[model samples]
Target chain A: MAGLLDGFLELLDVLLRNRVRTVMTALSVAWGIFVLVVLLGLGRGLENNVRWMYRDDAVNSIWVYRGRRTIPYQGHPVGERLRYTNRDHELVEARVDGLEKISSRFYPPIPDSVRWQGKIVAADFRAVHPDHRYLENTLVETGRFLDEADLLEKRKVAVIGVQIVGTLFGDHPPIGEWIDIGGAMFKVVGTFRDVGGVNEESQIYLPITTAQASFAGADRVDQVMFTIDDAHMADAVAIEDEVREMLSRAHGVSPADRRAVRIRNNVEEFVRVQSIFDMLAAFVWLVGAGTVAAGIVGVSNILLVSVKERTQEIGLRKALGATPGSIVRMILAEALLLTGTAGYAGLIAGLLVVEGLRRWVPENDYIRDPDIELSTAVGALVLLVVAGCLGGLVPAWRAATLDPIVALREE
Target chain B: MIRLVGIDKTYRVGAHPLHVLKGLHLTVPPGELLAIMGSSGSGKSTLLNILGILDGYDGGEYWLGDALVKDLSERKAADYRNRFLGFVFQSFHLLPFKTALENVALPLYYQGVSRKERLRRAAEHLDQVGLSDWSGHLPGELSGGQKQRVAIARALVTRPRVMLADEPTGALDSVTTQEIMDLLKRVNAEGMTIVVVTHESDIAEQCARTVFLKDGRFEGER
Candidate 1:
């Protein structure tokens, strides 16, 4: 009989007076959504960890390291070690299709050998081509990476990692400063960082041509690494085959010998890991939704009980001239209001927890920055509210359909 | 004005259909205070239910004013009850949670009256029942006689054409029962049409007219 607002106030009167029962019902609802949010956030954190693992290298790159041994093929000896040279790098550059950036890591046969101002900088050293900057995921902090001119001119310039600078330079200016590497002096041109972590940061980079000419005295390189263009990333396996065939033919080795040409198709590994995370994401949503559904069922069950307890009251309302429609409306409104408020409380609690994890836990090798999008959180809340209403429906209908005379029968 | 022609009602208890009311005819003229007396199992409650539109009759034409109220849907029945009939139960069914004022205002609420006007008219009705100061009290806080007065105020708030009381004093002691009958008589003297169903001779004798129900049919008029 009341207006919408008055009816709503009446609903509050009933709910608020039965404080313990209402809170108990709402608590179950809150717990359900709470589990959903926390689980989703942790899943996102795990995915972030997986994504962070790939920061070590460009996800689309391919690597061909020095082969172990080749099968005897076409009059070649069976146990010959497969050696890659400058010619192998050149042949791939000319013949490979859709190669974006190519480089070679030419080790100079020197170990534990970099020092400056008589201080052992304790760094790994790599003699690499100009594009090794991109192939190795290098972020230059100061000055610049090795360029084509640096390789062509065989300049003795080095790009040291940031950690290397702190050790070798010791607060002195590093750019254009001279550093000792196995009795040779190379001028530092830049300092850099790598997502590959502190170990990569403590290493050093130098021109490949200079190392080949100065140290090995031959066109020897340890590895050829390259990233493919976005257009060809999907066809990476085919390109790997073409490169392998050409390299085996050029080096006089068996094309079918897998060990002769040691190739690592990073794209395949990345895609495999990516599909795993995708499946994990789907699972998280399923579990979260199931939990929310359980909460909705709880809401429905509690409301059904409420309707049962108020049967005589409903009959009294009926006898007092309230239409069945109005009675139904009143109960439905109560259900919606209960769910809306409880769902919102759970969402806010989840967001606060996620934000707290982000601030406190920060970053780790796994589960970095546990967080969820605001839109996703709100979307979850709305979904729970709707499902809650459906849960309330059976009871509301029961209340409306009761025969007033029977309902009001005195015991 | 109210009229009933050949009214019939039946109840089925676990595959056994019990006939509660036979074909019966009655008419209540405008502004007449009337009583219907019957013992238990005499179908007085069933008759009141049919009259109040809280239950449907299996057969009959019921005319409240000019409208024939038969085979009415629950919705239509509720509308008729809200506009035409007000009920007072023996148990004084004031909603336990609402204040006395809110209970009184409920009938007006069914009429779609605004809250302010519903409150005003409800307050006036409480004043008429001599319980205006107790309007803010919940039913749990009120005495037996005071609760019945609140029920009366709720019934009268909509200014219904007919006030129906089902053993309105059945739950009260003798003194409180007399106090309630006095209030009903004062209401009847104001020219409001009223119908009360009871078994007590004293209650019926106080009404303007009385009818007796034996089984389902009217036996005689007094």
Candidate 2:
């Protein structure tokens, strides 16, 4: 270590002797590090933001939405068509094996008329079974959530979001308070905290029985949500296939026209979306690594020139008594110092630039604000050092192999 | 004592080989001032290089103290070059970036001497060569004579057993050359063996013994 330190000091003096060349080498290394850090940081930001979006929902949950068919009836083609019934929802709930939880929904006819206090706030009334709390990760902040008994008895109690309390009562409790939906008074049995985002907060929850009878005027459901125990359960796929088969058989729609009903897995969709971000991250890595490689190549070229310029001096040192190992170490140390200092400069600059960008950009759901993580910084530093060492190798070897007698004779 | 027996050296030029030294036999006791004189391409520098252990001869037996120069390993050869021999070049090859004192201290640095001791000894050597005031001056700042003096200081700082000078005064004016020769004579008188390679008879006359070479062999020794 002492020998290494001594060699390092000697190299420092040598590099300092040619300040311009040393500075140029360092700058090239700095540029490489800066590019690497920025690209990787942005990639990481994308990955983190995507994960944040998918955390609240169940991994194995699927939503099936009703679609219209364009089949001709008698003579003229039907302009619009709707096909789904509440009996299908009930049949699926009872017969589907491996179903952890199932909930049916009805879109209220007067969606925009719901009001808290005297303020008309935008809200969607969803008819849901009692099991929705566990499947959707909803948290009840006040009072009690609805149960199977309420749905069976056709109760008018509603579960409201935290936004209703803030908009209607000014931070006061909304539980047990009467809220009017389309001129019909309903008691608020529970107020849920905001679970996911704005969509979850702007909703009103009602029992499926009351919603189907009151809104659509028929025993019909627009959508059904199913939560399975394991995403990979054989029955999960079978349940989707079997339910679609049963619904088509019951609705008199051909199984081949299954496009009328769309089934989507939240977990699979999330993973697929996350993979797109991961690919984007990989692209960032490739671009950053390429930039660093360019800087390393530049440094290596400069060091090659430096070796040629100092051939005579190297020969003289060898003649005097400096060992070849000592000469090699001196050259390598100079390369490392140039790379390390320049790389660190770029890193600090990159961090400051990212932090500045972070301050200006608002939080976005899809695109994350840029920031630096410690592991990435350390990885970049290691890459810079390795690049520096590689850059010096050929020149150091050339210096070490110099013949003193021939070198002293060099003009 | 140093001995050279049946020494031969050759150089490969294009596809042919050029012999420089052929069966050269010589011996020098400690504190001897020996001069070798020869025309251009007469192997004067080749013999000096071999004796200083800077280059190996194709065929030779050179004994310095207990080590055979021809058979020494690369590491041992460097040790011999550092501990037992010093060289003075005609160009006064002081490292251009170093001060006169730093150039003189290089050998001591390789010897692992402390920086203070090396600097002190280098200054002492420079003072003996009559350039004490030029210790901090770089070679570029010095005159021809002053640079040669610094080279002489460097050669003597290691206190090696032998000092080999290759046309040491070749680049200087007559006055500067005379000063360098006087310095060499003084160093030789201090009990260090000296081998000065020159083509000038006047330079050879300064030594106690002189050898003249023709072709690749010595003509005679006096």
Best by DockQ: 1
* lDDT (10s digit) by residue, model 2, range B52-144: 777788886998867787766767777788888888989988888788998998888788777678889999998998888989998999999
Give TM per candidate.
Answer: 0.85, 0.81
**Residue A221 alpha-carbon offset, candidate 1, angstroms:** 3.7
Q: Write candidate 2's Cα lDDT for A28-68 as tens digits.
A: 87877777777776777787787667667776687787765
* Candidate 1 lDDT tens digits, A9-74: 777887787787779877887777777888899999989888788878888899998775658888
Q: Give lDDT: candidate 2, residue B202.
A: 87
Report the TM-score for the A-chain of model 2.
0.71
To one decimal, what is the Cα RMSD in angstroms of model 2 from the true structure?
Answer: 5.1
